[model samples]
Target: MSEEQREAVLDEALDAAHVDAAFADQLFGVVDALDTSVALRRAVTDPAASEDRRSGLVHALFGPRVGEGVSGFVADAARRRWTTGRTFVEALEREAVRAQLRAADDDGTLEDTEDGLFRFARIVASDRDLRTALSDRVVPLEVRQRLVSDLLAERATPATLALARRAVAARNRTFDQTVEAYVDLAAAQKNRVVATVRVARPMTDEQRQRLRAALSRQAGRDVVVQEVVDPDVVGGVRVELGDEVLEGTVSAKLDEAKRLFD
Candidate 1:
């Protein structure tokens, strides 16, 4: 299926608890069994076959392990029918992302992805050299990937790393989107609302703690925070929680004052 089609399938699963929980469990079972299906697994993973052939193999192999619904969904994936197991794994991985968001009881994992993506955008925007390399289409995937690995070493979690890899692989033209997607995925994993905050300077640990507590109270759940320090704020704090913005800065106050006078 096209990416649009695959996403549509995911949307279908997400829209129905009957799908996300029950059908997803079945998908998980079938993919897991693909390792053992021997003959059918090989065919489903083959690139030469038509979608019909692959779907047929999937039906034959996992019809027993999974329901008719899941087999149909798997067999319908156009990319998996033509691409390597890597793409299939990525699609499954995306489902796992959905599973996590479902488990966290968040709708679509938007806040989480937004927090991560915004931070990545800020990081890329702040560093010209890194941005140039990451966004360069001429840069081989291997090189860009290693750059991410080396940079993220000890800095980002394994989940974050995997997210970056997938995003970069899928959309190499914009690493910023990859970063955002990675963060959203992380939010799903942690079952927390992602709130990325910007400060003129690094926030004291106490300030971060206080912010987290306040956001949690407001959100009625634990909210994960990603701190970003941008000196241009000229000594103010800017907090972005989803679409909500809390601005506390002399500059903002001055701007407001100027607007009032004008």
Candidate 2:
């Protein structure tokens, strides 16, 4: 019910000797199934039902369809307490993305996958038509997925492509938002915090290194910088790390000075 409880369940589900792309795929399949079936979602998260009973229901419904690993994971998750069926489904989805990113990490393409997701998100954010097409439920789901695949096939890693297609589902969020969430998860797979940095110009390798190091020290952890070159920043930099924002941009300073005068 609490965030800690949910995180505990997730950590337990992911605690394995080895996690592969197949495992991630299986989890995604389960998430899709639960998301589409309201009755199934309710059945698994029913408060009146005993934990074992709920877990049994999961095994009965998915045991034959999914592999043992995923079956066990789903059953275990069903046995846990969730605030709502929607939260249960979201937890599964989050774990699926984490597992997929873990696979990319294992394959040494984690950075590529993160960059692909970030770049795709930026592209979608800039193109209104592309965003509409991807997020429009009126369009066939397959068509939207196909469009994503076609756009990223050559540029993205397999993990990135898989996540991009999943983003088209968009569940409760926008397409770009879902991709950004995946990008954050990718950074988490490496035990790094994500810092979205905006600047008037691109940073050189040395500048990037220094900024990353400074952020890492400030956060008390490794930090991955997702740089956005925004001319509106007009010099200096703006760093968004989770809820905290560090603004040193010329525009921000000018705004402050104008406010004082006014």
TM-score of each: 0.54, 0.91
Model 1 misplaced regions, further than 4 Å: 1-93, 96-122, 153-157, 249-262
TM-score of the candidate numbered 1? Answer: 0.54
Against the true structure, whose lDDT is highest?
A: 2
lDDT, model 2, position 214: 72
Error of 2 at 214 (Å): 1.0
After aligning candidate 1 to the native by TM-score, how far in Å is the CA of 222 from where it should be?
Answer: 1.4
lDDT of 1 by residue, 81-194 (tens): 434564565576567455534533444544544454556567776789988887677989789878877876765534345445545555334667656655655564556677
* Residue 134 lDDT in candidate 1: 75
> Model 2 over residues 131-181: C-alpha lDDT tens digits?
999988999999999999999878889999999999998777898888898
